[model samples]
Target: MKILIVGNGARESALGVKLQEDKRISKIFFAKGNATTDNIGQNYFESDIVSLRNLAIQENIDLTIVGPEAPLVDGIVDDFRKHDLKIFGATARCAKLEGSKAYSKKFMQTYNIKTAKAQVFEAYHDAIAYVKNHDYPLVIKASGLAGGKGVVVCEDVLEANATIHKFMIDRIYGDAGIQLVIEDFLEGYEVSIIAFSNGQKLFPCIPAKDYKKAGKGETGANTGGMGSAAPSPEWTAENQIDFEKNILEPTIFGLQEKNLNFRGFIFFGLMVTKNGCYLLEYNMRLGDPETQVLMALLENNLVDTIESCLNGDDVELKFSDKKAVCLVICSGGYPQNYETGFEIKGTDKVEHSTLLFAGASREAKRIVTSGGRVLSLVATGDSFDEARDKVYADALPIHFDYAYYRDDIGKF
Candidate 1:
């Protein structure tokens, strides 16, 4: 079977690696994939990416799997369906779950989905007025897309005012901040729950925790993801019920009831506290660093799973018993201004770890950095400590100028 992968990131690279592991998959194609993906699959729809429907038909790809939100939110799935192409992901209308935070907050409220109390603002001054009356320590978020740097945690009114200006006044994130969600801050440890849905049934993967803070001990600004570990050792049976009642069930029901043509993956960003599991946000696609660990621990046929979900059959995801850990190596000043184009070295020396490249490009014979959040290193073993040790050990040789990686991942 021939497959088409979308976007340019380690998540797509990991998907390419998993798809290749299945003997049934004959070939793989990528549309604007990263340099790392260049080594894994063939690039398709290189230039005429605007007409994806025509491109998919020209290539005759059996399965088109999207790995990013931009194309998916751009309505690639809806367009593919217009031409009878089999693709996986949410449609443009349903992608509001991730594309527009204001829409998602309203949807959550309409469906009674347990989440933080928040106020939406369209005008800059209106948001400022609300923040002035409200207390500090609130979460300020861009209503539209801002990659992953749109959300900011304000500790005082001073910081909240500054964030308001950065998003709405300065247009730091462009139209993404034109509308914003000023939410009440919920105190808890953050965790991610990823699931596969076909607009009818839901299959949950083993819970994974992603480190969003750029530094160790959860300090510093939030990056896309620093590292992640699978099976959330503390995820209990009771917790599943709480999540189902408050998040998963309501989310699926809301999708079905609202007639949102959502397929593929669903990422639930949650805050777990004594009160209950509260929904923090949602990603219509898979999580980045989390995908690395999930793919490493998966022992079943990923292609079959995708096919089954597309066909709307109740399916259970199977994973390896061993634990997996993924640590990201990024440019020095990531989630901010950072340098690129530096030739990377020592990648060949890594042993017992799977290194997925992101924000990198190939120059003649050498791999060079092209964006921040460069490469992801994944390792799996019988225990978390074993996997964490292997990740750090394998990361030693893989070096590039101004490469920054957290010293502590999975140390909690």
Candidate 2:
């Protein structure tokens, strides 16, 4: 089958690599793909949905898989469906789960999902008053997508008021900050559970723990993702089943009840504490660095699984028992101001596993940093520690002028 993967990031690179390994796949194409996919597939022109759809029609591409949320939330799948093309992603309406936080919170509340109690506000004064009256240590979140740094965990009333001002009054995240969700801070260890849903049926993948903080020991601002590891030991089989019953199932059923047919990857961000699991947020597409590690441990044919979902069949998703970890190498001063175009080197000597380029490109024969998060080094092993060590070991070989990476991942 000829498949076209969208986006130009490490997640798309990893997907391209995995799909290339499937013997059934005859051709691969990337629209606005990064330097990595250029080595594996036919690189198409830049990703304009209209041009992409035209190319798919002209090339007779059998499948189109989206890698980012922007296009999906912008109605790419709906456009594809208009042309009678088979595409993998949620429709624009279903994408509200990730596109707008206020929509998702309202959906969760209406469905009685296990999430923290919160109040949504469109005005600064109302939100600030709520924060001042409520307890300290609340979470102030932008009501729309702000990459992953929109949510601020305020430690006290002073901090909460500051965050509220920044988000609502100052408009730090632009219009995305025009509305805010002031939620009670739930103390817990976080884990991400990603599932492939076919509107009616849901297939859960292995749970992963993502390091969102830009620095080590979780002492920095959140980025898209710093690193991640699969088969989080904390989320055992029992924990998985409980989460499935309480969180995932309810979410799927709730969407259906609301007459929303959802597809693509549904990401459930959970906070696991002594009081049990609390839903934190939802992502409509695959997580970034987390996808790098999870795909490394997946043994199933991704093409077949995604096609099965498109065909309205229950996908029997399968995964390897091995543990996998990925370490992200970011540009210096990431999640803040940083320079790009610095040439990177020494990836060929890396052993043990794969290297997926995230935000990088070929400036002549040399690869240069193209975005904040540059590349992901992934490795698989029998244990999480061994996998993490192997990932870091492989990452050591790659170098750039001002590369940065966290020292600890999956330690919790």
Cα error, candidate 1, residue 129 (Å)? 1.3
lDDT of each: 0.87, 0.86
Residue ranges of candidate 1 with Cα displaced over 4 Å: 45-51
- TM-score for each of the candidates: 0.97, 0.97
Per-residue lDDT for 1-412 in model 2, tens only? 8899998889999998888789878889988777788888977866888999998999899999898888888899999999999888988998888989999999999888899999899977887778777886789899887888899999888898888888877788888899888899898789998889887878888889888998788887989899888887788666777787779888878988887786688889999977788899988888887788788878878877887887778977778998888888999999988999989988898897688887898777888889999988888888888888888778778899899999897565
Stretches of candidate 2 exceeding 4 Å from the true structure? none
Error of 1 at 407 (Å): 1.0
Please give the lDDT score at residue 62 for candidate 2: 92
- The local lDDT score (0 to 100) that residue 127 gets in candidate 1 is 88
Residue 194, model 2: lDDT of: 87
lDDT by residue (104-213, candidate 1, tens digit) is 99999999999999989999888888889686689999999898889999998889999999998899999999999999999888888889887687788889989999
